[model samples]
Target: MTVLLTIIVVALVGITFWQMSKILKLSQLKNVDTSQVANDKDNDTQGKLMLGFVIFIYVLTIYCFSAYNSFFLPESASKHGVEYDQLMLISLVIIMITQIITQGLLHYFTFKYRGKSTNKALFFADNDKLEFVWTIIPVIVLSALIIYGLFTWSDIMNIDEEDGDPLIIELYAYQFDWRARYGGEDNVLGKANVRFIEGVNTLGVDVSDSYGKDDKIVNELHLPVNRKVIFKMRSQDVLHSAYMPFFRAQMNVVPGMITEFSYTPTKTTEEMRNSEFMVEKVATINDIRREKSKALIAAGDEGLETYEFDYYLLCNKICGASHYNMQMKIVVEPEEDYNAWLKEQQTFGEQMSAQASN
Candidate 1:
């Protein structure tokens, strides 16, 4: 397929060159009488060539834009991208139609008005009907698009409780780290603050509320597949942004207040983890020299393509100098495994708390 496309592109380019050569040849001819020039038919080939080139240009441009705009861009948190894309397409379509119509008309006029032996300029008065048609047509088309854009923008930006679940997750960003708090079994998040932070109190979660007992402060976020996730973002020290490229979501994480954004995670973190882990294992074993290879081979005789893990929480914001290093490994396991991990973290946190109090 690629080879075929390459050949076709080459052929078109060659044809373009051939047409340009003919246009130059025709242009070099000495100025003939206007009547004679208008009567000539060979010069028409140049106009056709110009039209073909314009079509080719539009095709290539549309192809590249569609490929990049649709497939290449990752998802973002802002409901902004979706509507923006639609608006862009609408605008392009309008422009293309205008260009084609105007260019065609201009070309036809150039041929019709070509100078002639007759010393007479046809005086055709402009019709108000034509003027009204042109003006009103654009106004109507633009108004329709503007209304549609506003509707899409409103739908995505306004969180619909009727559509999405109240599954809230508080995301806190530090200078060089990220922490997540799941609403635990109750699915109700507890209050949190930066003032309460101690050497070990990473999230500074205000556990004073009775509801805090069921609130789980998991360092990483574990999302179920095909579920809408609403992120409640906060920054402890500096300004930060919560950016999830895959979900096409982004929102600012400020210190004083909270910001929110939502998206559906169609792909599970487990899938992402396994994919990345497999690649890492391949790279890790590639550098093993013969001396160490013997030991590694003996330890795992089963051809070393063996590590797998789920995807993780990544902070795309620059909160501080070490912002680039802020990330937490996430595992999107089955509900059973996810629950088990939560239980383990809870027990461990409790143990640590007991030891510190003692």
Candidate 2:
């Protein structure tokens, strides 16, 4: 494909230079009309080129959709993500259809109406029917899309307590890493602030608050599959965005303030790893890694390790220099596994007491 594109570009440039040389030569001729106006042959050639370019556009569009379909993200892993994907698919389909119709008509008209000496152009000063059709069609389409999008957004954002007692977790963001603070047992995150940060109190939980005593902070985030998880996001310094791609959830983490996003995990990490799409993606990645490993080995460097599939929590905002490395592993497992893992982590009060004793 690259070679083909390069050849096409070179050919176009060569043709342009050739045409310029001909115009230069014509300009030097004595008593010649050197206005360089397009005649019937030039018009016919340009019309054919316009038709060919439109054909190329359609062909490229079809090729891209067929060839790169596998590169698209797999199915969503959150309950509300299904609706989000549906809305996106609908929007894309509408845009594609509109593009095809509009572009085809535009290029076809250019070719059909190519200038000729015998032809007389028809002029329309105004057409109310045409104006009304174009205006109303877009308004109707845009209105429908906007209304549907609003409903979907409302459903995702309105975190209702009636939708079962959600597992409340605080996602704390710092310069270049993420930390998850779980509300142990009480299922309530306590008030926290940067001023409270000291000793082992990394998340700045107000230790005096009874609700904060049992808050467990950890480097990794884990959630119970099929359970609704509400995340309260906070940033210590600069603004950050907590983005969970697989779950289709993202929210800004502002300094001195907290943002919220909630979603139910529909698939466990293990289940997602075993999915067909994931399996194929992993294999393709490993193949590329193995090829690169050979080069590293030849250069006396360590080979890359094999990769495993896992969901991740990442910073979407370019907060700082190491923004790319600002990510945490997220594990969605069965309820029992999640409970066992949470129980093993030391609470804030315990950590503080241990530090004092030391």
Candidate 3:
């Protein structure tokens, strides 16, 4: 009944608009060009407006690029990230050039050839040379770009097991949080499934599986600098994206299937924090936080904490209401430090046994 009423109301509103349009048309003065065809004056004014609009857009683009340049991400932090950034920069350059040429020609031609009373429109059925020039140019450009992109993609995605004995890890995603599972001494992640989820077994590891007995799970992601790390991703509730912006790494996490991505961290967390770019960014963020903290303190609330630089693993996809808060800190450290940290964490078997004892 509610749907029917909504439909009726929508129909009435539409009909009322139709009637109003008819009345407006009928009410126009007889001398007015009711045919709604463009006249010489109309064309001239519209052409000038188009020209002005194009100029305005160009100025806005320049202003935005200059003013927001500082907000752009700092240099990539992974080995492949350099290549990824290069490809991105090339694509943007090409796009910018194409946009400038096409938009400039479009607006210039619109204004230069705008309709006039004495003008005679030219008609052409076909022009083979023109067609060939337009078609072949785009084909060549697109084909080259596609080929280059494919090669880059292949290089990034090609995970050779023989290469550097990459560390194996699992990134498990859920509605509002993430979990990192490290392959223990065997360096082989065990089998897992959503159905196996139970108390103290959040990631649903196959407890009976020998490979899983030594698996370690933690909330924070830790990577060894200069070491190739392969991440296997899985989602339990809904589709999610595992995004590590600094590494230029992102892969979809789908339920019932394991996705993979790999990258070698080139900088440790402390190294990145100490970099000039990061230092400036951290200072700017802290300044903003301090300003906000003053207001909170005045209202009898504790001031905000000082901002610091840290890499993060974020859920790029909007999975649920709390998706904005779905992130985990990523710490890249020396191989020895990473080993020490991993050694301190309990294995799945130990955790399960302890839970049982309790």
Per-residue CA lDDT of model 2 for 117-236, tens digit only, reads: 999999989999999999999999999999999999999899876678799999999999999999999988888999989888888899879998888999999999999998888999
Model 1 whole-model lDDT (C-alpha atoms): 0.66
What's the lDDT for candidate 3?
0.94
TM-score per candidate, chains pooled? 0.58, 0.91, 0.88
Pairs that collide, model 1: 75-248, 76-248, 76-249, 77-248, 77-249, 77-250, 78-250, 273-310, 312-330
| TM-score of decoy 1 | 0.58
RMSDs, each prediction?
Answer: 13.1, 7.5, 4.7
Report the poorest 10 consecutive residues by lDDT, candidate 3.
Answer: 28-37
Best by TM-score: 2
* Tens digits of per-residue lDDT for model 1, 115-194: 54554776878989989999999899889988887887676667644575646778888787778887777677767788
- In TM-score terms, candidate 3 sits at 0.88
- The residue-level lDDT of candidate 3 at 7 comes to 100
What tens digits encode model 3's per-residue C-alpha lDDT throughout 237-304? Answer: 89999999999999999988999999999999999999999998899999999999999999999999
What residue runs in model 1 are displaced by over 4 Å at the alpha carbon? Answer: 1-56, 59-131, 160-165, 270-323, 326-334, 347-352
How accurate locally, in lDDT, is each candidate? 0.66, 0.94, 0.94
Look at candidate 3 and tell me the lDDT of residue 167: 97
